[model samples]
Structure formats: structure tokens, C-alpha cells
Target: MSFESEESKKLGGIKLSTLTQRLAYAGIKEQKAALSRKATDNNIKQIQAAIMLQFGKLPAPAKIWANVRHKDFTRQVRNFMWKSIHSAHRIGTFWKHIPECEDRGICQFCNEPEDLEHIVLKCRRPGQKEIWALAKELWLKKHPSWPVLSLGSILGCGLTTFRNNNGQPLVGASRLYRILISESLFMIWKIRNNSVIKREGAAVPAHEIHNKWLYAINLRLNFDRALTNHAKFGKQNSIKTPLVLQTWSSTLMEEDKLPENWIRAPRVLVGTEQQSSHHPSPPPGRRGRNR
Candidate 1:
């Protein structure tokens, strides 16, 4: 079919760029506007100060912000992100603001406010700190140059800014990074909720959390393989440099059937192009000496 509109022909099909990055929680602007209106009576510079102090200056409204959460996550994961961002969860602090709720608004594990931030970032509850430490250890393997996370980054780590050594942007890395961050966030929340609401023992140990994350990754890899009908028989590991491998190389290198890929072919490294034709021998002294 021929083009029906001149605008379609005027420029090759390309979506307009976004200069704003609003989270667009259901009634966020109305909430912020309400805060502004209330600020005159009370010293609440609500919209500007709260967001800036907590999450740095908000970026211009960008679809990528929402895309990163929704596209990369299942329905439950998306729901979790939305609820946390909008402060609509059933945490005690939310109930505390009510005029006559029975909630004390303090963490059972640690005697502090039970707000989401306190739970995710400041809770020194036994297992919580260890889980974050383990996450930090894995995150460092992919981004060693990055520094410690601030309070905002810990809470909204899925949207944390990411780059590599030499300030080079790691293309396509954010999706995997978001997965890593989101998975850990959800896991922590699950552990805490189970303990408090369900009376299901204490928060899980860090080692268990680590293993659970690995299992989740492996399950995802297997699903990707099945979805794409990738054959197992191959001379090369297709997932060697794949994003999962790149992000979790420190741990995945030791795994046997990792990073299953749809394209089952040998991925050649750039510098190893000549190595296929040329095999190198270790200098003679070390090999002979061991023998």
C-alpha cells in the first residue's frame, strides 16, 4: 500500500524523542499539585523537595523509565514496582498516617519507622544487610568503578544510572542490571512480608537468597532457549558474551549450562579471530618443570 499521509513521507518513520521522565504513578501530578497547594499553610515544599532530596532531580518524562520496569518484568514484578513507586503498599507507615489506625509504624526486627525506605535501605535486620552485601558484591563484578549506592539508589536501584570503566556506556546492559536490581528488591520484600504477615520464620539467609537468584536466572535462560528452539548441539557456547554472562560473569563462569541462547553458534571474540588458526603453547620451561 502507498503512503496515505505526507507526515509519514516527510521523515522516515521515527518516534519523537522524550525530554521528560515522569514515573506517572496513577495520580502523581495531582498528588504533587495538592502538596503544592498545602505548602502555603505548612512548610511543605512537597513536590520539588521530596523528589529531589530522595531521588535526585527527576529526569524529563521518558518512556524508557516505564519500559525498563514493564518490559523486563512479569505481571507481579510490574505490580511490585508500581506499588512501591506510588507508596500504595500495605506497609505499617502507610497506616500510621491515618487518624485512628492501630499500627505503631515501627519495624518489629529493628525499633525504627516501618516506612518502605527504612525497610529497604536502613533496616539492619539480620538477613537484610547480608542480602544487600551479596548483591553489592555481584554488582561490583559488572561495574567495579561504580561507587557505593546512596539511599535513593538502594530504593530505586532498578533505575540506577549505569556505566563502565572509561565512562563508556554499556549498551543493552541496563535491562540485565534492572533484572538484577529488581530481583533482589522483590526477594527482600518477600522475605520481610513473609516474616511479618505470614509468620513464616525469619528473613532468609543471604546464601539462600544468592542461590534463589541464580536459580531464577537459570530458569529464565532455559525458557529463552525453549522459546527460540535453540539446539543443544554446538561447537561454541552461544551465551559466552551474552548480557546475562556479561553481568554475572563472576558467578556464571563456573556454571555448566548457563545463558542458553536461541542462536546456537560459536561466538567469536574480536582478538581471538587469529587464535582459531594459531594455537599458542606455553613457554617450555613451566610445562616440563611440572612433569
Candidate 2:
């Protein structure tokens, strides 16, 4: 039985279903196009100024918006960055007008107005500090020094550039920085939300926080490795094996012991200096049994 009304289907020689689908697609396309125009808001201006202060070059507002959709970012992290740049998260003053919800706008730990910056950067939450510390330790392996991380710098991490004394671009280091910054920021926000909503403001333990951060990093490492398969992601989309190696070279567990091409290596973990000493990394294609 046909569900479409004959009159509706014949109106423009197109079925009602097809017309509805076209209209819906057009609406979605319009919304996406609006994002570029929205880039002129104060939030983007602040990010532009922050990027300029940190990198010594002002990226256009459009570039900042484009960076939020960087191909390297996972879909969830990309959306979070987009919301952050738009200041769309219901934090800080979003609850000010709600009846009897004023306290929801304040951070219980710091007793200050709550916002994305406070959650990710300024809050003294256990997870916030430990996550960043772990990220810095990992980054220090890739570069000699770490950049001064501000809210703006963190958001504009996609535009971050790394260079050697010869003024050559360090592509691996830049990619690593973007991944670490975006993941750490998202982790902090998760911890904060869990504390405020689920645990009723209880603090997560420091050790647990560190473990969570490492897990997130290792998960990304595994995802990167999976994306390197030409059969899966194709040449254009797949991350080059060398780039992956360079991105994670110094940070893997028993990195020196691992083979040169370890893309297919099993149980490849990102480990700290202390942790690396306890667990030896296996060479590529070695399937060993543990007693």
C-alpha cells in the first residue's frame, strides 16, 4: 500500500518523501554554512588574539573554525571543540536566570563561576591537574620544551607549529600536541561533569585520574595505528606509518626495544619512564605466551 498522497507526490513531479528529504538536507547544509558566519563572534576573536599571543601570528577567524574540524580529531572531540569555540556549553552564566539553579553555575571546588576554561584549565580538580601533567610529560618526550597552555592556546592547538633550529616544520610534534591538548581538555570536562552530576562533587583519586589519562592516550595510539591500514582507510585518508611512528616514537613503552616498523605490534602502550621499567615492550610480530 502506498503511504504517499497522490496529490502531494504529483505536485512538482517529485514524491513527497523525496521532497521532504531534500528540504531536510538543505536545512542541514544551511546550518553548516551559518557556522562560518558565526566565526566573527567574540569567542573566536578571543581565540584569534590568544593564538596570536602564543604563536606570533593571527590566524583568520575562518581558520580557527576550520581547525575545529581537523581530520585528525575524533568526531566526539571535534564536536566538543566546536561547542567550546562557540561558547555554547551551558556553564558559567547559563544557569543565572533559572529559578533556584544559581549554584549550578558555580564550581563547587573553586567556588567561582564555572565555565569551560575553569573546568579544563583553572579548576583544582584532581583529574584536571593530573591529566595535564601526564600530557606535559608525554609532550616533553617529543619536544625539548612545552608551550605555556592557556584556554586560547589549548583551543587553537590545531594551529600550533613546531620547528627545529633549521626552521623546518616538525609535523609530528604539532600533530602530537593537538591530540594531547584536545584529549586532555575533553578528559577534564568529563571528570568535572562526573563529579558535579554523578558523584555530587566528590573528588576522583589522583592515581585513578592518571590511569584514565594514560588510557585515553593509549586508546588514541591504537586508533591511529588502525587508521594506518591502507585497506581500511585508503591512502588518502590513512595516516602514514612514518608519521605515526614519529608522533609516538619517544613515548611508547620500551620504545627502544621495539622494532622500527611497529604499526602491527600488539599491546603497544604509551608508558611513563617509571612504568616502562616494569614492562618490556615486545618486538613486532612476536606473539609470546605469559606464564
Each prediction's RMSD to truth: 18.9, 12.7
Model 1's alpha-carbon lDDT is: 0.50
Candidate 1 root-mean-square deviation in Å: 18.9
- TM-score of each predicted structure versus truth: 0.57, 0.79
Give the clashing residue pairs of candidate 2, or none: none
Candidate 2, 1-291: lDDT as tens digits: 878668866534555556777776776677656753474376677778888887689999889988989877889999999988877788886688789999999998999999877888889867777687778878877787877788888888888888889989898898899899999999888888788888899987665666677888888999899989989889898888899998888778887888899999877888653233334533433321211
Model 2, residue 77: displacement in angstroms? 0.9
Worst 10 residues of 2 by lDDT: 282-291
Stretches of candidate 2 exceeding 4 Å from the true structure: 1-40, 273-291
Candidate 1, residues 1-291, lDDT tens digits: the string is 965665543322322232223433424566756744453222112223433554476532243245436545656777776566556676755566577763556786787778777776678764455455555545554554433444344434444445566766564455555665566677778777767766644655544554555555545545433334335634343333355444434433323443343234343111101112134533433221111
Index of the highest-lDDT prediction: 2
lDDT of each: 0.50, 0.80
Which candidate achieves the best TM-score against the true structure? 2
